[model samples]
Target: LYAGVGSLSNIGDQGMEAEEGRAAIWRLDLETEQAGIFASGLRNAVGMAWEPSTGTLWTVVNERDGLGDETPPDYLTSVREGGFYGWPYCYWGQTVDDRVPQDPALVARAITPDYALGGHTASLGLCWMPAGTLPGFPDGMVIGQHGSWNRSTLSGYRVIFVPFAGGKPSGPPRDILSGFLSDDEKTAYGRPVGVAIGADGKSLLVADDVGDIIWRVTAA
Candidate 1:
């Protein structure tokens, strides 16, 4: 099994000393009673799912904030074993972050993610959808972006569908649920946190944290 571990502070604000063994995914070997870091440098690897076609593990990551609104974008990507994604030193593959001291060695090796989920979307939940389960969805993935609190204009707060072709993101994301933010963008009606395929195989289940509700979407 795989489990995610997030960093203690943003961009090692408390110092690199505080970031030891953090921002990584760990694999547990129950038969052998062993556990170790499977991947590293992911700030918040919240949601994880395995693709049915290729069995590749994918995750939606929440990138760092406080670097203005659009400096770095959150992303969804297939996880690479023993891969290092930039955290404090760089973002989006070699885009240096001035806030943290430069690390040329680590920055050079940071692996770029497959797809961007927009900056500061606070993307969290992820689940794979097989073809024919939902009309027009095809074989792809569904993600719940909980939205951002720091930006002037809110992002996310809805569910999005990303179509996949050949086991990779093939096109732009399609909005499944929206309007969580108020008309004036002052308050939130609901925040989407997680998504899953319902038992009926035709409905998509959503977890809304702010409204304290669970929503089900089905083709009419």
Candidate 2:
């Protein structure tokens, strides 16, 4: 299960409602209406998947607030239960923004995310390629950073791959699908929101919300 803060609020901002912005990972026991918190403090995790090899759950998180067009960078993270990724308090480990009040006590209590995906990427869908499938893909997670609209220059709107080693994320992301925008790099044709490995074992599926189309990518 993946959990993250669903809203924008600093660690101890009294004005912020927990229910409004907080996200939590929960497992539902269908036998009972019982669910438990697996993790917390995620701004918005729109995509999640479990790796078949290590049984680890990974998520792509949309960080809180635009932060005046350049403050906080949206992220793709490997979520761990009982982990508190600093949402409104701190971002990308230690850069503190004053717009959101920081509680030194709570800030010290938060766990930093696994990877920093740069600012305003609007990361959305996440998927992991199973082993022995695509020759070059290996077994890593691919995330669709949905690009940015709340920025002056704009960012994201492309598909990227995050390689994994030893059953964990090893490094930063590499662009896999680009050129969605025109030559000016201003207008966009498709806004990728989801990514999944095709059932054929050799194709990649991507959903573009703006274009209202689903694209299939195959090994060349």
Model 2 CA deviation exceeding 4 Å by range = 1-5, 8-14, 18-21, 66-70
Highest TM-score against the true fold, candidate: 1
Mind giving the per-residue lDDT tens digits that candidate 2 earns over 128-204?
87655556666688888778877777788899888888877877677778878776767899889889889888878
Residues 62-152 of candidate 1 have per-residue lDDT tens digits of: 9998887876899998999998899878888888889898889999999999999999999999999888877777889999999998998
Q: Model 2 reaches what TM-score against the true structure?
A: 0.86
Q: Residue 179 error for model 1, in Å?
A: 1.5
Q: After the best TM-score superposition of candidate 1, give how far the Cα of residue 199 lies from its true spot, in angstroms.
A: 1.5
The whole-model lDDT of each prediction reads 0.91, 0.73
- TM-score per candidate, chains pooled: 0.97, 0.86
Model 1 vs truth, CA RMSD: 1.0
